[model samples]
Target: MSRVLRTPDARFEGLKDFPYAAHHLEVGEGLRLAYVDEGPRDAPVVLLMHGEPTWSYLYRHIIAALQDRFRVVAPDLIGFGRSDKLPEEAYYSYERHVAWMREWLERLDLRDVTLFCQDWGGLIGLRLVAALPERFARVIAANTGLPTGTGMSEGFRAWLEFSQSVPVFPVGMIVNGGAARELESAEIAAYDAPFPDESYKAAARVFPRLVPVTPEHASVAENGAAWCALERFDKPFLTAFSDRDPVTNGGERIFQARVPGTRGQPHVTLPGGHFLQEDCPDEIARLIADFAG
Candidate 1:
């Protein structure tokens, strides 16, 4: 049996702007992945994938804005949100995350997906798109990248070191700090809800280190393979990166230059920090909704 912990339901009680009912799926033995499935079942699927230290709650605003016209599927990756967490941190890996999401997406039979991914979301989601291009209709990348171990930024280096060495994994404060505007205490508390204590944060703590920052990194070759496929992906791709995120400020240029789909597209730079969803959800939601249409 894989040692796992499921957060108590009470921890997520009365979260601000996150009223969607929870849906669960068995991703592995004794591990159930949770997601928020809202809007009409037959509508176009808009898959919202979140990143490290934050769960689907990070996209509550975006979900609320787009659920009216699109089927919004926001999943809590294993070890985050209401999903089951592996008590042993060593079990987590970049490839494992991509595989877990592959299972989740296949089981759900999500097709014609308009993917909105950020942070680690892009790392894993982009791989899914490369491996299964026909499943996606369009893509919108924000404050995220698929790194193949070259030109790693100083800001990311500092973040990686901090994530590995921080005594207390302050999930809520980390999200707040990554936002351009300050978040309310209640909102911060909601971000903290998924992890009852530090042990549940093993996945978050390991995410920064899992990033492929060098050629020797474990996921480098796999990511390079994905990039090869992405180069040929002619589907619509948009980069709505934010202006204030030091971690990924110049990443959009690389995507636009490399990806065939980015040609002639109106790529944008929104005003916000790394977690632009929180800082500019309405604009981001509108962009996605318009792009999907």
Candidate 2:
């Protein structure tokens, strides 16, 4: 797993003073995990996992707001953010993702976690929780789903094709296009903080492509196994999916119907697109804190 580390200047220059303890953990032979560890050491943990294109930076505002009360731990997944970049598309599989995250979590000894997952975060994070349900206290899913491939929205398919065919995975520019509001110059650059170029975007390029479109996908059976575990996961579960985000719209309904943990919970409709944190961090934070109570 020998890998290249992308040292994006904008990421470091702009975020040098951000209020979080940045740490990198050795997860595998060539993979190192980059994460922000903040707030009281004794506070209950809120583990945040991001999706495609964006890194841990996506949670900056939410981290700041909640770190004061909870120990926030958000990691940049291997390909998308400030973590190691492997150029091989073959290296970027659903199995690799779950394996990488599990190794990192085991190394960090993460437990009693209030897991918050969005986008790919939910895809990978739900597998983590389902694999070892004892480690988590509750689960808050926002604009994310653990796909079992019973139905995938057409919006997701369109975006999936775009990511695979693009010459360069412009993390920042693509993110701006998806949002309802125009991003400021600083905000756009902030999203681009991770990758210096296309060389660092293998994870972003392959993540969308890795989503199981049909039950025959390589990891479909594994996802089904996770779903089987989730069928009886009687824990605190809340869904705060956004009203926009065509790609993931109604995904919460699938979880609510199948996952026992989400039964009878209030489903929140937030005002934003796919990257709702960029659109309404304050509201998302409020919902998490309110639900965690």
Candidate 3:
């Protein structure tokens, strides 16, 4: 364990279009995980998992659109949003993230869940599905993949280099750069809110480097095992990738080919970039609603 930092509550004040109250669960010792729990408690759960350099705020639009029909629970990954952050980047790892979120999921006792995961969300969330396959009913993966240390994309390699070398890790600017549409100054600020200063950005800075793109990476074998579980998953998996995300342009193909649940599914390529939630939230919401129904 390392020294933990929690973003000041004042930093999150007056966020745009993100009105849901955050709920907290102690997932680790002295660690409180922040999440948005909206809609009917008894309604079917639709877990929205976000990726790097983003938080549950990334799913505000999708949560609003789906809250009326389903229980939308979106959690900020331990270091990303309202959750506790570790000042030491070394404290974060692929397996630890999965273990933390797994504890959070189990503590909530979420069942028959419909997961909508993107980016590292898929990396961690898919591992959750693989570990607790019985807890998930279906999955909607968008612009995400489970890499097994085979190879890295040119775009991802570029991102890796930029992330490690950049002097000032601009959280908001990096997010804005990934989206297809230009983010308003406020929305961009919300992304920046989680990290008031550079000290709070250890998790964000290390996330890109954590992707197991080589055999020597830590989670390679674990991701390989997770894929084996996915291959046996037959519960209606869908891939709604975007048209403009260079980093993960055709990443969905492997899931369609390997996962039995992808067969006969209407996988789509939406008009957006890596952060498609920003580009087309309503459409993504509708797709999830229809798919979950």
Candidate 4:
């Protein structure tokens, strides 16, 4: 195993509106994954999965809204938030991420889950649903998808280019750019907390390039297989896409058209940018709770 770095607890101190206690589980040798497990233990599980350059903190407001009535589990992907970071970018891969999350899910024994995933969250979470269809009761896809590399959006293309060329990966600023509204300084700093320095950003910096954008891409076959399963998924599926997210503006239509569960559902276009959780957490949380019902 490559050398891994764990962010000190001090960095996460004083984060605004994110006060949930941190829980850690070992997903790999020398790698510990951090997540927030809140609400009633017996309540139905509502899994909130975040995206690139962000972590469980991205869902704080949403968590606060749902924890009273539902069990909310939000984990920081490896290399983000309180999770252990791989020192080398090469250690991060689409398949590895899926595997890590798959193991984590099985370890937790989560069932009857209602998944709300965005960006990379969708990419991996959708695959998890496909892999363990019986575990998922429903899905709420927000500004997210499982791409089979047929086409690339212009907004995504720009982001791909920028992620590669940028010398320093500004975790917080990158998130702010993705959101419709500017994040407060403290919030932005919270996003940066996981990465004490540039070396800690290896996974974040490499995530964009790992996206499958061609037929021969590493994850294309798996994602295509996932799409096949999703086509047959008869469970409830909702698309709560945002109105201002250029990167995923029209992406929801693809899910609506392809996934059998999406038909006749009360899909909605929410107001905000890519990170709608930041712009309208309460609304999104309510929508998710209602959809899960």
Model number with the top lDDT:
3
Clashes of each: 0, 0, 0, 0
Query: Which has the better TM-score: candidate 1, or candidate 2?
Result: 1
lDDT of 2 at 166: 79
How many Å off is the CA of 97 in candidate 2? 0.8
Against the true structure, candidate 3 has what lDDT? 0.95
Q: Give the alpha carbon lDDT tens digit for every residue of 157-200 in model 3.
A: 99999999999999999989999999999999999999989999
lDDT of 4 at 101: 94
Which ten-residue region of model 4 has the weakest summed lDDT?
23-32
lDDT of 4: 0.92
Over 219-279, each residue of candidate 4 has an lDDT whose tens digit, in order, gives: 9998989999999998999999999987888999999999999989999999999888888
TM-score of every model? 0.98, 0.95, 0.99, 0.98
Q: List the global CA lDDT of all models.
A: 0.92, 0.83, 0.95, 0.92
TM-score computed on alpha carbons, candidate 3: 0.99
* Shift of residue 177 alpha carbon in model 1, Å: 0.3
